[model samples]
Target: MRMALRALPLAFALAPLTAALTPIDALAQPNPAKMTFFITSAGLGNGADLGGLAGADQHCAMLAKAAGAGEHIWHAYLSTSATDGKPAVNARDRIGTGPWYNATGVMIAQSVAHLHDSTANTGKQTSLDEKGGMVNGRGDTPNTHDILTGSTPDGRAYPPGTDTTCNNWTSSGDGSARVGHHDRQGGGEFPTSWNAAHPSRGCSQDNLKASGGAALFYCFGIN
Candidate 1:
């Protein structure tokens, strides 16, 4: 009984140290490999007509949820052209303040400004989807590098009286939409611009495919 009683005190005394280390260990550990940025593995299948910003946002949320990232707010990185007296919406404004990371925990950007900089790291290999799969880029079979952005080089909506946004992302018809080269290499005007490579042939899915795209876009966590 005496030996048992003595051993109890030692166990009790060491308990506080163990308890203290628990929190320290947690603090020392890295953040969970949660996906905060990704390219859409697939689009809504209706060409550029993503049913407008709401529908596109919903699509992003749905895909993220399926990839186990439902807790974060997801937004499609697209711009809307001005028409009918409505002001244009910039793609940069929709997504939240940055510091976004991919599924592999690679930091893509620290802020919107950082993302727009010429030296940004959002390339084909880094801009993976929520499932951590690499979207096909230039030089790959079929060449799906043309990611739809609909925004200008500065990540803002095009000027009024223009139709570079596929009728504000509400048309699957004869309109054209701006596309980016996720691979950061192409023959278009902005070949080196990851999100502003050039424009697509048309807004149809078949057209997008013909122009080396799969109708995909980038999705970012806003929270």
Candidate 2:
């Protein structure tokens, strides 16, 4: 009886601590099903200049890590144009070969071809963020539907000519970036294109907003 009394206080003291840790423990467990696709809830503040492709990839990895989905290799869906003798890079080539899913366990695409197909399973409905939250679209308040892709409608690098990638995602000052409509809504040409809507007037964050964007992009897990 004396021993039981002594243990009672200890149990009571530890109960709240264990209760506080319950949710954290649940979140810390690596999801066995895992996440494979997400639209970044935010972006690097320097406009479309994601410090080039490497920096963009790092951003994807960082966001995935924060969301407890860091086990898989993450890649940003952004294209780079060849300039100053450098070779061009396609956004399609960087992401892994498909079968991506949103945080809510919803599959986005089964393969690369399927991802770019007109019937792709992605859009405002499936293209959720790391938290499985819906991003605002063309008809939503503020209308942040434009997502940065920098690739053509076919997911290839733009031909050498006018700056179609904010100087290959390195300039947030004076260059322009190609954007897409995640909502598949109005953009005049390619209004229904999910990954290729139109271009930004300039590379600044405000400029991206002018075209109905919040400087966001898509991230995919390769592994």
What TM-score, computed on C-alpha atoms, does each candidate reach? 0.84, 0.84
For model 2, residues 16-119, the per-residue Cα lDDT tens digits are 99999998666543342478988898989988889888888899889888888889898989888888999999989989897888887767889989899887
Q: How many residue pairs clash in each candidate?
A: 0, 0
Count of clashes in candidate 2:
0
The models' CA-based lDDT, in order, is 0.86, 0.85
Model 1 stretches with alpha carbons more than 4 Å out: 1-33
lDDT agreement of model 2 with the native: 0.85
